[model samples]
Target: MSKKVAVLVAGSWGTALASVLAANELDVVMWTRSEEQATEINTQHTNTRYLPGAELSPRIRATSDMEAAVADAAAVLIVAPSSAMRAVTHQFKPFYTPDMLIIHATKGFETESLKRMSTVISEELECEEGQIVVLSGPSHAEEVVKRCPTTVVVASLDKTSAEAVQGLFMNAYFRVYTNRDMLGVELAGAFKNIIALGAGMSDGLQFGDNAKAALLTRGLAEITRIGVEMGANPLTFSGLAGIGDLVVTATSQHSRNWRAGSMLGQGQKLDDVLQSMGMVVEGIRTTQAAYFISQKYGVQMPIADQLYHVLFQNRQPRDAVEALMGRDPKTEMEVMKLETWEQWHS
Candidate 1:
């Protein structure tokens, strides 16, 4: 018999990942707050609201009850949005054990706390932060559910934990790599959304390929700048979590961040764009966090700054573009290195 693997919240990504685990022949149980949705998954075998045309594996199941979902699971994967990370993790805590492997696939920081998702999970679970493994990379949930050739990196300070997760998720169509740079992987995954939003804005503005290309290049520099400032290895930014995730999110039509930015560029209000998206636009919240993070850390994030103004201050997207294009002159290469970041700075 396959061990049960519990996934929290059957959103698109969560549902997609549940499918992957089911394909691997694990008894996948997904936790959802919606009883109707659970019934739909159990009976119809489709999540039409999210992945419209995709057929889910029979091994996948859904429930509205949280404890019931994790009761007999050998491993638990949390895929809640960043906004609900704390609350959802708090709910998952009573069932947590040091022996059960815990992994999170959420991308983005806690806007209220400016902490990474892993940090929030650890604090709630009362486990060493290193015990948590973060799964991230260029893989899109849409593609992964299709059993498409998808690759991702799993990072943890615990080598054994990383390798264990690598084994659990790896298969022919789904390739997994292990990275020891936990901080870099998480930061790269979250920060790239800001850039992807900007890329979509550039495209929405009809700024042409040259403009989008420049945005991606400089956006990476800024992401690496802050990632290193937060004690991440600079080399990690060159890997899948960094450059690879950045490229895919910034360019793909599947990216909500890109779609949100495109709507903003098309002159729609942020509130309306979000309502239209009808799903979580991570970059919007992430941009809010990044703006403050850059300020708190004393690092310069020109692109993020402009986006903040555009997003919150009602600065026009074109004006944001102009502000970026009209920055002060300096040496083209300014390095970001934390001379030993004491601890994950609050």
Candidate 2:
């Protein structure tokens, strides 16, 4: 018999994972905060609001009761937004154990605490390092649910923990790679959202691909700078969790980050943009967290700073883009190498 796996959060990603697990012929329970969503998944076998046309597996069930969903599961995947991770973890912690693998699909640090999703999970679940794992990459929930080819990374200090999840999710169309650089993978996942927002804003402004390319590249530099200072491996930024994820999120129409930024670029207010998107644009809040983290570490994240201004300080997106273009050019690789050296020391 296949082991039970519970996926918290019945959002697109969570539902997609549950669909995958059920397709794998594993018993899957999806925990939804909403009774209506739970009923849809349990009775209709479709998440009508989020994933419109996809037919979910009959083996997949949904529930409003967290305990019922998580109780029999050998592994628990938490897919809540970063903003809600702490409170959600607090609620689940009492039932957690070191024997079960805890996987976090949420990315980004807390704006106030600057704690990574893994850190928050560790504290809440009181799990050892080996028990915590992070799953991330360019894979969108919508595409994955459709069984499209997608690749992602499972990052953990423990190779066993990483491989365990890699085994769980690897199938015909989905490939999972393992990486020891948990910090890098996690940081890359969080920081890419900020850059994706910039990419969307650029696209919204009708800036050419040249401008979009520059934003994507420079945004990577800033992410690497802060990540290295925080002890993440520099090479991880060149991997799937970094560049690959950035490309997909920044460019895809399905990305809430891109949509939010596009609306902002078109002169819509932040609150209005968020309301229209209906889902949490993690990058907006994550940009605030990344900005504060950079300041605390004394790392110069120019793109993040510019994004912060655009999002909160009322700076125009075009003005920010122009400011970036007008900056004096220096040897770009020099900064990249410096960030690498900082990681070695950190």
Candidate 3:
């Protein structure tokens, strides 16, 4: 029999990834909270709410029972929303085996604890931090399901674990790269959502391409600065998980963070915008966590600062833009201090 893989949750990203695993000829069992969704995938092979018109593979099956979904599986992929990651992992703990390849594709931090998804999962699963692999990058589920050629990176402190995940998900349409800098990969993936939200807000406010370009560039510097402070490799920010994910999330119509930001920029209240989207806007919650993270690490994240004000403090989006533009002048490469630059090059 072929190796079986379990995907927790049937969200768009999860479903899309399950399709990839099924395409790679692995038997995929997805665990969902909704029995309706499980039946839809098993019967109709459609998840209209998430994937819309895309038809899932016959090899992909879903169940509401966590034990059934993970029983005898070779690997289990946790794709629950960051907010629900802890609960979802706890639910699967009874069924998880140490030898199973554990991987997660969720992006965002625990708002209260400000823990990355991997940290939260490792704590709940009682596994070594290095054993958990994080898969992230610029890939969008809509495109990935349609086989539009998506590239993503999987990172783990253990090279063998990362490579195992890469092998499990790699195929013609979906490409996976392995990175050992798991901290950098997870940080870049989570932080980029904040910038993407800002980008969408800029466009919604009619700031045009130039403003968006500046935001992307400066936003990246802010990300790199804070990431380095938190002990991530600076170069990781320039790779697939950083700049690559940033561009896609900031610009793509499929991006929930960008859409939420656009709505906010158009003068819609946060509550109303979220109600209309009906999806977990990871960036909004991430912005909250990033704000506290910046403070904890004593890093200057001007863009995130302004965004927090706009988002929570009810500062007008236009006024926030003006505030960002009107900050006291400083050198462009301030984020890369002289000492840090030399150390990086050396």
Best by TM-score: 3
Model 3 lDDT per residue over 264-316, tens place: 98999999999999889999999999999999999999999999999999899
Ordered from best to worst lDDT, the candidate numbers read 3, 1, 2
lDDT, candidate 1, 305-328, per-residue tens: 999999999999999999999999
lDDT agreement with native, every candidate: 0.91, 0.87, 0.94
For model 2, the stretches where C-alpha displacement exceeds 4 angstroms are 337-346
- Lowest lDDT block of 10, candidate 2: 334-343
* Stretches > 4 Å off in candidate 3: 337-344
Compared to the true structure, candidate 2 yields what TM-score?
0.96
Q: What is the lDDT of residue 193 in candidate 3?
A: 97
Clashes of each: 0, 0, 0
What local lDDT score does residue 271 receive in model 1, on the 0 to 100 scale?
Answer: 94
The global Cα lDDT (0 to 1) of model 1 is 0.91
Give model 3 RMSD, 1 decimal.
Answer: 1.1
